[model samples]
Target: MATERPGASDGGATPQEGARTAQQIAGELRSRIDRGVYRVGQLLPTQRELGADFGVSRDSIQRAMRDLQTEGWIESRQGSGSRVIRARRIHTPKARAGQPAPISLGPLISEAFEAEEVSLDACCLTAEALTDHVGVQADRVARGEVNPRSISLRLLLPSTEPKPAFPAAADDPGDTRPYERWAAMVEFHTGRLRDRLLALQRGKFVSDVDVKVRRAPVTPTHKLYLFNGSSALHGLYVVETRAMPLSDGTEVEALDILGLQSTLFHFEKTAFERARLIHNSLVQKVK
Candidate 1:
């Protein structure tokens, strides 16, 4: 697989709207990369093409591309356009039984949504990536591509009131900027996720919808996602000390984790564990 060049970016050509567009386009592209829709070493559509497809300006595309590059997802060149660098990742010690292909969270989530009753439980620091993937499935339900009678979600998040172990000031731990920034992200992404799920119920598409998000007082070192009480995806967070830019145009030394890059381990109730119950919340008992 090809690797992105070190310290390569779009030369900071992001326009005034770059801030908003960075999240908008980068998220969509990120989801695609995660799902393996765009494989490693494959050149993504040119900025002109992506702008037309996504109905955004070329400047916004540039900004989004830069964000992707910074995240180690893609790399861009002067004329060759941007290409995916790290999409699918492999880890050892555990593998899905009888499955030849690598498991993707996208497909598993899609499968759950296809059932008459869909249940999801996730424990994570933020719902940013989950929100992105769920957005795609919601669009499917809206378009009548797949119809499910109900949807249920239980999301466990860290309490916003406490200062987290991550996204903290590296030089001075007392700086509250990181905590404030983390709070804003939790509000924005989780709120959006809740609203999107409820909208399906209001539209009368899904006959029933239950979304319960709880705040856990402690920070979790690993993220866990349970799909329909049958399978679980777990990934451990790796913390790093880096410089984070604040909204006020100043940089701060910070400690953070890149959740997207973490390797996930898949476990099944029947194949992986012998325990009688896989998830206590839903009471998924193994046969």
Candidate 2:
């Protein structure tokens, strides 16, 4: 019988196997962070929890966490668990001439505008992000860079009349000011987005620009963007306990969702059939 080596599964040592496993685990965790399954500034699950979830040994989990930390994706403390420091770049399908890489929302929207006709449907806590990116695209159009003849945008925001949910004061249940602030924010940003899109038509940059806004009764748990029926980008709203300062200098602990910091995951229609169906259904429902 052959004697077993120190790092071997059988007789031969396989140090590379452990390294490869660590790499694979690191990649998966990185993907999750990029896709918002793990969010920035959020503490990651404990090593034991992660080890169980990944069906790996504690050493493997430690190696993967070390890899993430070395790559600047996370930070670990002695007593505290690992926390997400930053998200990795979203890999786009390809690159285009004279256009930047599609790593974030702005570039993705600009890429969408390269089409002859553009359709953007988004449902989120606020239209602030969409509005910001549209502004960037508007500048591109203004420069005669992208000339989409028709642009159709539909926005679905939570109804403010009836307080939906979340953003409530954690300690003081009677205080509803945080909810009110969120509602006002949604309304303001939605209005701004509408005005910006309408301006595109007014400027004669685009022959047809249709902007529609609707109120959803349900509080949004996730933000969804379906781009021209081809691809979908989704991000979950993570409710966190944080303190919010009111206009009158009153600070209260409340449950809140960080919008812009949420990592967005991209999916193509061909790859995720169920996601495609859900996206289509949502579009129709909001229409």
Candidate 3:
């Protein structure tokens, strides 16, 4: 009587069942890899050995190895047997230090503002930067800095308000009143947004803002704003652009800020949640 191999089962199957047998063997091998029974860079058993173990033909074992190779789980060398490859790491986006700060557009809109000759793209991008800035500021606060409060917010429909237009497209055009009104709006919204985000960051309360931009562009632009007490945090904002686009050339711009406001708010409440989680995990490991 011969000794049974590692993958051998009691029942004897026919050659017609070879494909199924090979698949079963492959699955077992994969399971071993997943469970860490077979470590990366470890050579798998020879075809003959695996065939004997699984009570299958050497040809069947070869087929399974080919499958594993095609799937990128293992690589084969002429002199060296098949070796397992470490799995690829997942890709994630994160904030970088010493880079241009994120921008937010939440504060740029006047209650009843207007503009002309401004490219839709410029307006949209600016709005997005504002919201992104808010997120950045919130991150700073989380690190125990003297940063403004910021929150992740979504703008809902009907409550959406359009951005008022600016007089002209001059780069640093010095019209005081429009600029002042614009600055005031930015301050008001930034302060509100920042406070809400800080509350969420400090675990004080869970709050959200819904910003709706109407008549501006087909696509809605989003922004994050920071508030320091009653004042808006200077130069800290973040913006995210929405995917859906309204019909082209629509003249209306609207923004409606909405969401839950309370200490129960968690940082995991926004798009940056996963990145934040990864960053926290890495930091913990370093410590």
Candidate 4:
């Protein structure tokens, strides 16, 4: 038999194999982080401990840990072991700072108007972008020319107190059906004011009209209204209350307007009309 070389018994698994092993270890650690097993700011196991756990050499574990640190999954500080740093949340173009931040409609509208050919996807994207600025766009297109100053808005409000009790089925002669009773109450309370309220809830209403309904989770009993203009958006809030013997009825607790415009450039007339109508109907009933 021929004499074998000193290291020939072991197969030729080159240095590249070691690097791959480090990559694999790094991947496993990443999975653990993703699963929340090692949360942000939590220290990871020592290289020796990790190497023992993964059945790899300490060198391999060190390489892997270094890779993770470089990738921002973890950080290493002086005298401190490797600890996870939570990945920063992604920011969209529309995110703003401060409470009641005014949404900017310029960039989106400009892009839409400047595009050479607007496709269906472009229109959809435009609508979505507009939603980020205002709740929704109007269904009907404003006639004449697109005037940034022509936009108008109104707000709808819901009654706070429970509607007054109606006559019982036995007492009423015309109709006592549950549906009829409910319809009557809704009509009495919301009928006259319904159109205006609807206009305000939906971002688009009649030509030059836009509405905004803000429901705050902190104050669940009331919904805020915003009537938008070309350069400004106004606000009003209505609250529910117990009925007293003599009351002036529900009052507008707050009213104010801030600068903000809707993204209306290059929008289809049909889409504008539809969006306005849908928004109106939905906002009318929420409060």
Candidate 5:
């Protein structure tokens, strides 16, 4: 977007306020991009239109656009306003020699349990992804492939008491069938995962297996897995348009987000700025 800065005589905002405005704008726009409001390859709205819509000056819009570009969400050209480079994947960990190839969620879970005392802290829309992988770890323990003396897992899932913001009917706000289905899935998977972990204790496979779950007040825009409080794997939830089947066999097109299919970017405690920020935030949230 070709945004022009407002002059001093225009009674424009101060530099600090302008920076904060730019951050807010950038955040909102990032969410929209993840939600598929602006699909890949589509050009963003012009600076003048964005300024009018957000009620900000052209300078703020420019700053926000620059942020998007730096994050690899969009690309700006001389003649082209700004095109979405990708709908997902703002960052990825760099590969290093003598290190094993990056692993998926299931293997990551198994590896985490190799320690004597295993602890996992996760925050996501649902516990489905964690549940699936924990099952894999349980299978290994059951088969004597690996065993840890203690297993402790804390899961933060969106509350069921309140209506969820996602998996809602695309056109009908009052229809809650999608939300109900999602909640049922969460309950089943979490219960099964917990059963497997607890069985290890019951069968004397391990001394302690403590599984705790709590409801998060907000819907998750990203999924985080903090392993042993030192390593982190983070991924975004990208919006998807697909048809879903109901219990009665009726199908409906729904707007939803996928967690497992998205790439899980790996990070160490001190690797990069974004990873470090997420790591610290999750550590504080769990505390």
Candidate 6:
């Protein structure tokens, strides 16, 4: 349960009315996040800002933020502020079965940008591929081929602060060199993605643009993309042993995920994706 601040109750004429107001505020915030107003990895407007916008007291805003946090829509830290970790899923047009579903990064990205408000949420081992596609879209907007009022991009990358779950040295799992190299690669790509999106706003190509990169506690086992509040693509990362060279010229055998080679499938088509394994393996493992 989320602990509320000392005076964090929001309501109306009656006690129940106050409860409803809090729910309404939380729902509205959730809808904004669902629609990309507050994309994943983006810090939500401060409580003071929200209170002023809603014409409510700071207590009311705090109540709403607490509700949102309890529902896993946002996370708040003491001083850093509240940030969205997940974008509430909304239904979009399901991909046709006949359409080519292989990872066509560019075309899909272009299609997503056709709307006035663009929201893209991606989780991956690295932002390299997403950076490339976003750069293309940003260029298109610059050339006036495609025009969008706003663009929201949220990137989720694996956090390797204390230790990483992947890219561990195969010979010695405790080694951190492989993870360090991978983290550097992630930072470089994410930096480019942020710069590209911010450039659009800076150049007056788009009226509003937000780009956020957040670190997740776990290494990604799959790559996921959600865009335009409708479409989704997903692909699993295949972990294997590979050689990773460090900056010092020494190579380490590491268990790594080959993200570039992964193939993505439409989210709607991902049902029964692994239906072939019929053995009752649980019998052997759990009993």
Q: Supply candidate 4's per-residue lDDT for 276.
A: 91
Q: Clash number for model 4?
A: 11
lDDT of 3 by residue, 1-287 (tens): 22333334745445656666667778888888767787655678888788777766687788788887766566676776777653221111233585433221222221001221111111221232333334433433444533222233332211113333331123334433433334355455545545645465456422332333423322223222322211121221122222222234322222222111101110113447656878999999999
- What TM-score goes with each of the models? 0.63, 0.59, 0.28, 0.29, 0.59, 0.57
Q: Which of the predicted structures, 2 or 5, would earn the higher lDDT when compared with the native?
A: 5
lDDT per model, in order?
0.75, 0.76, 0.42, 0.40, 0.77, 0.75
Q: Local error of candidate 4 at 48, Å?
A: 0.6
When sorted by lDDT, best at the front, the candidate numbers are 5, 2, 6, 1, 3, 4
Tens-digit lDDT string for candidate 4 (75-117):
6756667766532211113324553432223223322322222
Segments of candidate 5 deviating more than 4 angstroms: 1-103, 270-287
Candidate 4 residue 54 Cα shift, in angstroms, is 0.7
Task: Quote the positional error of residue 3 for candidate 2 in Å.
Answer: 60
Local accuracy of candidate 1 as per-residue lDDT tens digits, 1-287: 11222222654334444566557788888889878788655789988898777766677778788887755566576876776655643233345687433244555676678888889999998887677667667866886968989899999999875666877888887898977888888899889889988999999989999999999778779888899888888888878887877889988888887675567777777743545343552564432
Error of model 1, residue 14, in angstroms: 38
**Who is ahead in TM-score, 3 or 6?**
6
After TM-score superposition, the amount by which residue 111's alpha carbon in candidate 3 deviates from its true location, in angstroms, is 55
Q: Which candidate, 4 or 6, has the higher lDDT? A: 6
**Candidate 6: worst 10 consecutive residues by lDDT?**
269-278
- Best model per lDDT: 5
Kindly give the number of clashing pairs for every candidate: 0, 0, 64, 11, 0, 3
Model 1: CA > 4 A from native: 1-102, 271-287
Q: Candidate 5 lDDT, tens digit per residue, 178-238? A: 8888898888978887898999999999899899988966778888898877777887788
